[model samples]
Target: MKLFFLNVLAILLRYTNASASFQSRCLAFSPESTIFNSTLTAREYVTKGTNLTFPDNDKSCNQPFQVAAANLCRIALHVPTSNRSSITMELWLPEQWESGRVLAAGNGGIDGCIAYDDLAYGTEHGFATVAANNGHNGTSGKAFLNNPDVIIDYAYRSLHTSILQAKKLASLFYGQKYQKSYYIGCSLGGRQGIGAADRYPDDFDGIVAGSPASDFNHLYAWRASFYPITGKNTSADFINAAKWVVIHDEVLRQCDTLDGVKDGIIEDPSLCHFRPEALLCQSGQNTSQCLSSAQVEILNRIYNSPLYGTDGKLIYPAMQPGNELKASTGLYNGLAWPLSQDWYRYVLLNDSTWDASTFNISTAMLADQINPSNIRTFPTTLAPFASVGGKLITFHGGQDQQITSFQGARFYNNLARGMSVSSASLDEFYRFFRISGMFHCGSGPGAWVFGQAGAASAAGIPFEAENNVLAAIVDWVEKGKAPEGILGTKFVDDTVAKGVSFQRRHCRYPFRNTYVSGDAKEPGNWQCRGV
Candidate 1:
């Protein structure tokens, strides 16, 4: 039966000729026969510079091209479920393909669409990139709760189904199975990548998860826990965001030069000790620029320590320096307060009219009963991920304001413990790099934009940080060379004019780049320092 279906699909594909006019459709084939059971249609779209006449011949695979824009094809899949209605998926595939690798990125919020740039880059590299809306689309956090399908999809099913379908589609298009598959994303996408590794270990060979929100239930609870202080307060009145900025500024001010260069980037935020109250506005002055007394206290709580158990042991680490408070909105903030709130109110409580402002943090403990984020409920364990010899590289900006880098560190530690793999042994299968000044999947003022300054200006030269990450992953996968320490480059447009030169170094884990001796502007004078 499968052979018959393949023949039919081949005949159909042969006649189609990969033409621009050919319908970009999704077909549900029988798992055994690969015969079209049903079809989900996709709108014909085009990426910048894509030639429809080329058919499935995507030449961008071997060439370097600047991404001006991306053409996206979105489709919804009704995945079968025993307990819920049906799960819906928002799948994105770049219209052109130059390679066979498929990338699946997870969205941060229930509302925000997929990371378009990430998908564009993947498609440009000849990979089919897929991202899902995680069930429902809404600004409210309570939406997921009322819908059984949404919860199931958000939990794991939707992404898994999407990946399976995407791979099948790729097989049909390329006439060959994907040579290799990879997943790259941050925050929620990070979580999705790890989730894939745990549940469906065979999905991808390489995964780059930046600051994943692994402990979904506990982390959501933590956000609700903070609502008591931050929910009502504006940027001026809120203590959490204000104290975070104060800490961030103080860290940069004191440690900016620690790396032997004061180029405005903090090489390592962990090295800097920050005091929030030190920057408090004088007396009664309260505005967007400064924090008030109440705000400072709240910040202290956020940074000082996590809520502990009866044994006084730590449950979670405090938010690290360099992260912005607002980043939480897109990644952490939206997930915790808005997304989770909407889920709880609408799905579980069936009360769409419930006021979010009235949410009581004191009752947060009850969340476990309503929406359990326990790891046990997850379909897969960390064992299969390591067993299959998969390669996972995760990078998070230390200055991310949303989901904390500490969370990534904590997840790694847990994985290390669960897998019984030594830190060094785990490096063979998984690695995490923390970028000191970057923010949320490589954006924000603190983000290191290597080569951003036209490749000719000293002040705006691109840092080779992100590109190095891409390189390291490729080398690790194809060559079996596990990245020991990644080399980071700092470029200066006018090196001769400034009497300086570009510097490069291998940044190790738990250690940050620091200056050992000599001029601060020079990169060679820096060393990786441990906290």
Candidate 2:
């Protein structure tokens, strides 16, 4: 009885001491006192802690609310430079359940809010997480107006600075260096991950990029060209929300079964040769379910014509075929996408109030001269990062409405051709996967869960080992066992805890998940076969 009491007392004492140490260290966290030379902006312990809800006060961009975290210390820093804009960073450190790892997440759009949701997601998984506003304070392109320094910071400098300072903070707080570092991002965040590999090769051991917005200048230019051909009043204009559903159905009907399966997802989008003209109204049989001749032409222009540079070089690949429904309502319809519009207005013209209607492909091409985000994220050279034992895995949704999967495909092809390296050689340090029916980052009708943290767990994969993309990357980096394929789960009710409706083992690029004589809906029934 006496020994038991003594052991309990010792455990209590250790817990108390650790708690006390955390509180004391939290108080001593001063950004200016850090090893890095930077002016401290804000230092405070978030007593309420981390939660996913966007705060009411700062609801401008649906910013994630930091409300229920325990022992959370929020540190902000500003590293000034010769330019007008400075590098600003936010580091979120966990007081308890420290994973001894660091995960740096990235931002979206032109918004300057630190990715609070990603930070919270990382902390929940016991990782010390950090994010930046890409060097601005709000979700507005107005910040980029005539500020070259700000643009430079937004391009790649801010994330690099954030990662460096965050690692320093992690070392200081834990009293031991982090064992591994990883990055998770989609869209703009995806672009930033690739940028890190290029500029700061040794920064992270592994990177997870989804739907990367690479080839910045050309992407915007190509996206803008669609407006001239499909604007509301243009001669070739043909898409509307109602008409798009008809086309969406047609695409699936034509190609959804090419993988020897009858599920909704088009497993091999590359093999699906869907023709839009098939849906064109017959003669004068105009109906809401059918597209007119003008509309067919517009769809063809958007999906078949590759944007070319002034020198006749291919600039951007054509948009994919099956995403017409999403494009018609969310991103591109009969007009320009707002992100593409803002790139030309603020980043290029330096005019926030510039009329988007006045913009055209020619003007967008001119804007490339001032492309501040000219970071070669998809460069031919991976020797620097690869030599140091870095691993990178990227995935793109086949139906991504914002940044097309073709963009990723183009980069991979370019890298292979540019370096004269075989695809197998590139797979040593890099792998790209394509999710069949997903949209931009997440959401859609596909088995969209890949165990990526910082978002809702929808993949019904029960095991922790199979569900987290960050964990998978960490295993690859530390254990050196590269992933052949990642399991994807679709929840019955689109949730993680709910029963899995179906699952698919998404094969890495250059391979297709072929159905081989079994239940079509079952993941085990498919084989990852080469194209």
Candidate 3:
């Protein structure tokens, strides 16, 4: 009996040791280790959800996250790019890495915070994931002030160096080089992916960029321009939170049923002419239930007017319909969005006291002139991206209050126009998926959850090429199976436990979701059609 118990004990010990069995190899990684030249400054084997600490001042980067990751090797790096500038990055190497694959995440907004969600999202899929603080340690673009190298890092260098370091580290950690490398991010991170495609084409085999705010310099100008148009909260033309609700209801009343169903979502806002005159106050109507003529004019400009530079050139398109309530709460909350404020204040003027009251076309023209490390991700063509055999998938939400989906479509058109190639040829290397009713990266009345960054990661869905966008891109790169569309899930009340409310197969570029038969919620009832 004693001998039998001894054998059982040995088996139990092995089970307990499995997680830390890689410790020796994990601990072997340090700046001094010479297996490869590395800027890997620190290492830690985290367990029990310990918070990764940063310099105390960097509160933005130190937002407590689940570094409680056991069965993983966490690495910190500092890659010096130029005189007096470096990038802070983190890499998480999972033991059960999926088929020697590497995934790197992109940062959002003017953010220098590591995208821990994307990192978690990647690692959850059995990938070795890496993300950088984008050369600083906060959400403020003030880091760009008096720091041109840092600006350069934010522009494109940080992602390049971080990915290079991560790939090498991942290769060394696993005793083999990665078979494939990929990138995942949305918003600013999306811009970073495109920038990488432009400058560092060989860095990633597959990229999933969502709601990319490319043409960022002009986008900043465009974001700031709204403040002057909307006026201050005290202005007579200003639409308050209540009136914005009225506008959203009116929008739904007019455009919601255009897709052959009434689902409270405007699947395609472009088709809706969006007459603000309809919202004009009826006689004896309560002020809360209608807009004044002055307010009606503001709505017209917000939706119908195009932004132009002083040179009479179209700078950016107007805000598309269906995001009014969200806009009321955020950027249109009586002031310019702080991200835009930070851009104009720190990046352009470099004067902390400067206000955006005078943000006219000339001011925007100056922004275009400076361009700042060429951060504007507006590509004349993606020939270089295509020549290197890269596969790029970009998606923008139809209900996105932040960026107009039109810009995302415009980017696709630019790529084809620049290359003088047909959509079919461009479709070979790059594809754009327009997700109906998804706001920004995720959420809205539509099926918005689909393995995207941030909130979408919460679903914890099993990765499959059909269900997940990340897996779709992977299949595209590895198996040469290009995706026609992705299946988006809208959880009941946006909660996974409540069960799914609906599902839709969001179609790719040059195709629109056309309702044919059966049920509106059933994904198969809809088909991707060229309009």
Q: Which candidate has the highest TM-score of all?
A: 3
- Residues 1-531, candidate 3, lDDT per residue (tens digit)? 999999999999986686567776778766336323346666866553556554543676555645434367788776678877788888988767889999999988888988876776677667899999888888888888877888899989889988887788798888898889999999998999999998888999999999998888888888888888889888877888988888899988889888888888777777777998997889898878888888888888889987888788878888888888788877677786788888878888887777877778888888888899999899978787778789999999998988888899888888788889998998898989988888888878888888877445546466888888889899999899998888998888888888888999998878888888888999999889886
Q: What order do candidates take by TM-score, descending?
A: 3, 2, 1
Error of 3 at 140 (Å): 1.1
Per-residue lDDT of 253-350 in model 2, one digit per residue for the tens? 99888877777788867787778889878867757888877778777777777777776777788887667777777555656667777777888877
Candidate 3 matches the true fold with a TM-score of 0.94
RMSD of each: 9.4, 2.8, 2.6
TM-score of model 2 (CA atoms)? 0.92
What lDDT is obtained when candidate 3 is compared to the true structure?
Answer: 0.83
Select the stronger candidate by TM-score from 2 and 3: 3
TM-score of each: 0.73, 0.92, 0.94
Rank candidates, lDDT, best first.
3, 2, 1
For residues 159-210, could you state the per-residue lDDT of candidate 1 as single tens digits?
A: 7766777788667655578667777666777777787888789888877766
